[model samples]
Target chain A: MRSDVLVGAVSILFGMAYTVQTLHLPKAMVGNPWAPLFFPLALGVLLVAMGIVVLLKGLRHHPSSAKKGGSKRLIVVTILICLAYTALFERIGFIPSTILFLGGLLFAVNGAKAWIVNSLIAVTFSFGVWYVFEKIFYMNLP
Target chain B: MELIQNLLLGFSVVLTPLNLIWMVAGSILGTILGMLPGLGPTTGIALLLPLTFTMEPATALITMCAVYYGAMFGGSRSSILLNVPGDGAAVAACFDGYPMAQNGRAEAALAISAIASFIGGLIATVAFVIVAIPVARFALRFGPPEYFMLMIFALSATAAISKEALFKGFISLLVGLMISTVGIDYQTGVLRFTFGLMELQTGIDFVVVIIGVYGLGEVFKNLENIASGGGLQAIQKKFGRIWITLDDWRRSIIPILRETPVGFLVGVLPGAGATIAALMAYNNEKQLSKEPERFGTGTIEGLAAPEAANNACSVGALIPMMTLGVPGSGTTAVMLGALMILGLQPGPLLFQQHADVAWAVIASMFLGNVACAFINIPLAGLLVRVLAVPPKVLYPVIVALAFVGVYTINFSVVEFVLLILFGLVGYGMKKYKVPTAPLILAVVVGSSMEQNFRMALMLADGDFGVFFRNGICWTLFFLAIGSIAWPFLSSRIKLPWNRS
Candidate 1:
């Protein structure tokens, strides 16, 4: 359950998966046989070897304490909010989605202090930025 | 004589009204952004890249370089006033700067920092100009094999020098290079890692990764800190005086002079940047000081050396990028990306082909340093007020800006999603104490490395020994091996000396 071990295991899995994918690439007709696959395959093997070393070191060392409960929950909530905002970005429109996203983030961080002020800021920022980008810069904002 | 003429041409280009205004504007904006917690020059340049899309290449490049200079100056302000480093490079500044603020000499600290920054930047710019011309000429002889070896040296040096565990650094680099391998393989006309996704066919955009990793990732970390009640502290408003006395000047001058070249040389090396330069300069100053113990207690020399080193380093990083087409830091890599976006290639040919753009950029750096120092010194009091805006309010706006910046670049939904994904990954990397610089640098140079690697092999008819056949390539290969081995060797060698 050590962090290094987890990292090493993930790396090994990724390296193996990448090696398999590289093997499946169609061969080239000309140039070196090692052209496309050479660099990646070598990297994969190096990765696996390093992962094993890290895994061994991790097993030998003491595990560090895990992240705090509240921090973890907050990070999870933030990620979910960001995912929702991204999913609804075009559908809800830039202004509405951005306002909601900003307002939600503000509330999440500060717990609803000065609700009117937060709302004003959220609206102004979303609209102001949208205007600058769309109207001034001529970037199309969905 | 040629240098003088080129500089005159540069000055003429930069002296235009619009370009001058852009330079000043970039300085102001970059200073403010760099003063913000967790946002450095890289983020400042990345966030503002979309605005320059419509401008001329020379104008766009000048603006970005000005921002780069402004950010370096601004970084010292936060380190001096609040003891919070505005960026990684400013960490050394905090050692002596915070103590100065604590000792009620905040104004003196700020003044000396600005002055030292100006001197360092000026000297480094001069050095960059001197080094770049010959380096570019020398680089003209570089074939594919030499380029490949240079990139390998860069990668290895980056991995070895990063503060993280060496293996972890290499792993982070491998991750980046692997990401670069995604999309259609150009030579074979085959999709490598597309996995049937239309978006994957083009691979991931570097800007998207940058925005996600540095911008949004920083936000996520700040959010957790805020939730944990570990947010920004209220900054002290009373700055006594904006001037350093003659005695203060006397103490700072020598350290500033001594650290400039040290910082510049460090900056010239690819992958080792301002952070290392500042740390080394600070340490060297401490060693040479009569009062070594006074270093962490806010001595003027302690404050000056690192500030000078880091600011000088900002200019030092440009030399390799301009002359050899290799970025020396994350910020330089972003600037390199900016150059490519503006339809200009950096490298030896840049000076010959786009002399106007190159010279203007160089001239703008000179102008930017003067502008930033003047602006920073007079406005230090007002700028520190930016720290008053709590994380709760500021981070949300930053997140919105990041999204807007990324969206404006290509407006691809998949890229935006990739931004979020990398942001989380970047957060995880930070949590695990893995350095992100090498990873970012790898992504920037990975494609070029691959191209040069293949080209070298093709030219030599698949002979593996072609990489070491030439002296330049052989030297670079050894340098790469040496850099990677140096850390381990140093640790082992120290044992015997310690015993003795």
Candidate 2:
């Protein structure tokens, strides 16, 4: 599918769904009952209209020869690493989970061939950031 | 007389020891962040946000402003040396800047960029000083209807006035607006599209989106580039001399002066930013030059004009954000949001309510511009060593910092989840060839836009005609319509009346 067409279709679906959700918002006990719904409802309708225009425009154009979504797997791996980091953050603490997260990303993207260097960087960045935020700023981390 | 007193007041605020330290620190950090691809002023300020939480409002703003322009300066460094722009605002620099490096005049190109930027920024700051007070005073007269109209003009112009991607801009904007609607409604205390998550009830912070898109999103995108064998290139080590010659200086001075105003004008308009200003300066220089063909071939005029205009544009863009509280671009939106968090809200009353803070921000722009040039030039050789650090390791560190930045927000792991999610969203937007500016700008302006609109409605007793009750409203309405129409009209049809 053409990119614009796919995006447009997604937008239309999103807009319609959003409109329904806006409609279900609890009625306001104060001020106009319609006030909360007004802006969002307009946004939903406009998004659907914009989607149609984009879809129509995409239909008129010839298929593009743009570069394929290069390195899809790499992106997936990074996201998974991040997800694991998020899940582990509170349980494992900032220092340990961050090192694992950074180390994991480095290994995946930078390659394990330079394992020692990547490990060092991940460890150093994790510790350095912790020291600054916790010690200097008096801001806590999970 | 009043102007001089205000200038002194501004200087006094900036001269404080704490403010000076933060300003210098911000300039240094901002340059480093700006030099990296995918990070711009937005990411730079957002990443440093937690640091500013402990600072005085003036100090925090000063530091962020330093980062804002410092990144603009550093952005051109990569454009000249590596033939890649650090951000969107630096794209025009690549047109002639890269060719200059290729010609082994990298030193000259680097020097001229700093010089032009310094002169341009100083002049633009002067203009800002002259206009800021008047503009703020005038803005005091604006009511809810006027503000709502202004919001419409800014949003529609942002969506409509791009060189291309008009519809894509709209899509990006609507998505941002939708994101803005996610939290609980303020006036009526209605729960919004919170999806049962307590975090959603408070609303998704725009700072998280910035960190995700600019920091993590760029990293995600870079993984693709690295996989495709398009990682950052090796750096050049030596330069014969780092200063521009009198000959190069003579050619550049005129274009730099001419373009600063153009850039400043465009910067004041909502939705426009340094990228547009730089491009316009480049185009204007090309048209006026005797050797227009020399443009893409590394002409000094081409390089200097864009460099000057973009820096000037950064300074000029601050006017609207500071004076009227309507940010014209993503960078300013980030600044506005960060400042609001710092408890120094920018708007018509800012100068009246917090005159010291307002003027200090203006003064800091001049200092930041100068500080960035100092960093980018004398330390150009030292800084390029950073580029030698392989992207493989650098990207991961950036991701860690992004998480840390978000974590600083509420010190919650939940914010990290939101960061990653927005990062993915940012990556998706990139893949689909959509611009991120309108999306971010919308997110920052979204809540306030809705608030002003509702307030206007409430005061007018639900009569829609209240919007058109004033001249300012009509002016904004017309400007918005014109901006939306121009893209379609400019290409498709030319009437006979145009023949005259």
Candidate 3:
């Protein structure tokens, strides 16, 4: 469906914002007429052009379906899980949150017997990774 | 004599107990990961990169190379026994490998893949050793202007590789470049695309982007079709007696020999990685085969050619990473990231200053590939059993792993959001048939290309013609032109503007 339209439109708006921002850089300090800003500015222009193409393509692919899909409910739920995991990682810790988040995700996907298996696997994998990073590699993990 | 001395020093470092342990660990992990569906070397390396923070650069690099080469050797396991390709490079392997498995020749397929991989790796290693020193010296001659031209070439080639319409590829490349410019500008110190958000000042982490694109995107894509039924028969391929018959060896040997150099050289080129080399090798082999019709149905040559190409390409990828500091493949990109994290800037100067380290990495790759061949061939059956794991169970785990990996990078909530957003973008790009490789290549090569372009301009005193003035630069430019023109030239898409 034209689900990519809004995303492409937002991208074009961001590109415009970037182009306006690039204008403020001092060209004199940039030296040569091409300057450091040239490539970025050029990219911004191309981004807007590409965004427009994407928008048009998306619209043509689905004039009405972009806004009408209950399946997209899953997207919101997924996003929330991500946010919850992010907000909770340092507090609840990476291993706990990762296993819990994975359990929830698998459950949502109708995983049946796979949910418990996934939970165990997630706990093991996350802790295994954490142990390697923090204990062995001495990385300061969240 | 100098080479021998440096190599001996490298061997000393690589053979250290700690590094050897890391190499074995990396290879085992890599083989398992490659045996799984959807995950590739990129995910394996990226997920491991954050852990490399404490290891010495030489150890980190050798470990990463081990994983990369091990994955190449092991990816065929899934393709040969389960019909599921482990990665893009292995996609061609499925054309022949799976049928061989179904025909009860899985052992033969696995055996030929190991031999081909070993041969390809060996040839590419020799080429790497021969080419690296001279190439690093030659690349040292590049001034900012030359660097700029090279970057532009990388960017242009990346943008053009997309299977989508040129305009869409341009958009994806532009988005990457724009994302790259979001942080404080190198010259002006002007913040870009930050929109007053505090987190934006640091720019989006490359880890976040990669995890989103490769890891999370994979999860979402898998979710879209999880209900689709597929069987996971215990890889019943007879295990212990793996060996290609004389007929099998005869068919594969010639193709492996032909594909190694082709794959290696293509892989050595900046931005052309194992995936391309594998695809090109398969296509070239098919074109040359008297029984081209047997390609997709299951041919040993198809299995051998792409397997050889992937391993050759692994070695080929090291050429630019070691010589020019430009990574030709995603695994090498992570290796570059590891090097950068170690505060070791790799370039022409790197070879002169750290010959021992550079040569050690090269020497370790040689040993690692040999190690992978020995280790992987015996474990192919066990690894192929990875397909028995239901996708339903695996997808969520992959997503969780990706989330945790990115979150650990900085404990930033914003980066997590960025991961989901980029995953959606990646999913969208996939749906539209837009190639993600170009966008990634652009992102990886983005900084160098931009820096070089501006340097070139400054060196020429702002003369645009300077890009064309040098014969080498002009040749590169024309090659870019040729790359652009290639599709239309080969296809029947006649364009008036394409007239020579």
Which candidate number has the best lDDT? 2
Deviation of model 2 at A110, angstroms? 0.8
Q: Write the per-residue lDDT of candidate 1 for residues A95-138, one digit (tens) a residue.
A: 89999988887777656866887898889999899888778777
Query: What TM-score results for chain B in every one of the models?
Result: 0.96, 0.96, 0.91
Model 1 regions more than 4 Å off = A29-34, A64-70, B162-164, B492-500
Please give the DockQ score of every candidate, comma-separated. 0.60, 0.85, 0.42
Tens-place lDDT digits, model 2, residues B51-107: 787888988889888888888888888888888898887888998999999998999
How should the candidates be ordered by lDDT, best one leading?
Answer: 2, 1, 3
Model 3 RMSD in angstroms: 4.1
For residues B136-239, write the lDDT of model 1, one tens digit per residue. 99999999999989888888888787323787778888888888888877787667778888988877778888888888888887777777777777788877
| Docking quality class, candidate 3 | acceptable
Candidate 2 chain B lowest-lDDT run of ten: B491-500
**Considering DockQ, which of the candidate structures 1 and 2 is the better prediction for this target?**
2
TM-score of every candidate: 0.96, 0.97, 0.89
- Please list all clashing residue pairs in model 2, or write none if there are none: B271-B328
Q: Name the runs in model 3 displaced over 4 angstroms.
A: A1-14, A24-36, A51-75, A110-115, B162-165, B227-240, B290-297, B493-500
Clashing residue pairs for model 3: B145-B456, B148-B452, B148-B453, B151-B449
Chain A TM-scores, per candidate, are 0.84, 0.95, 0.64
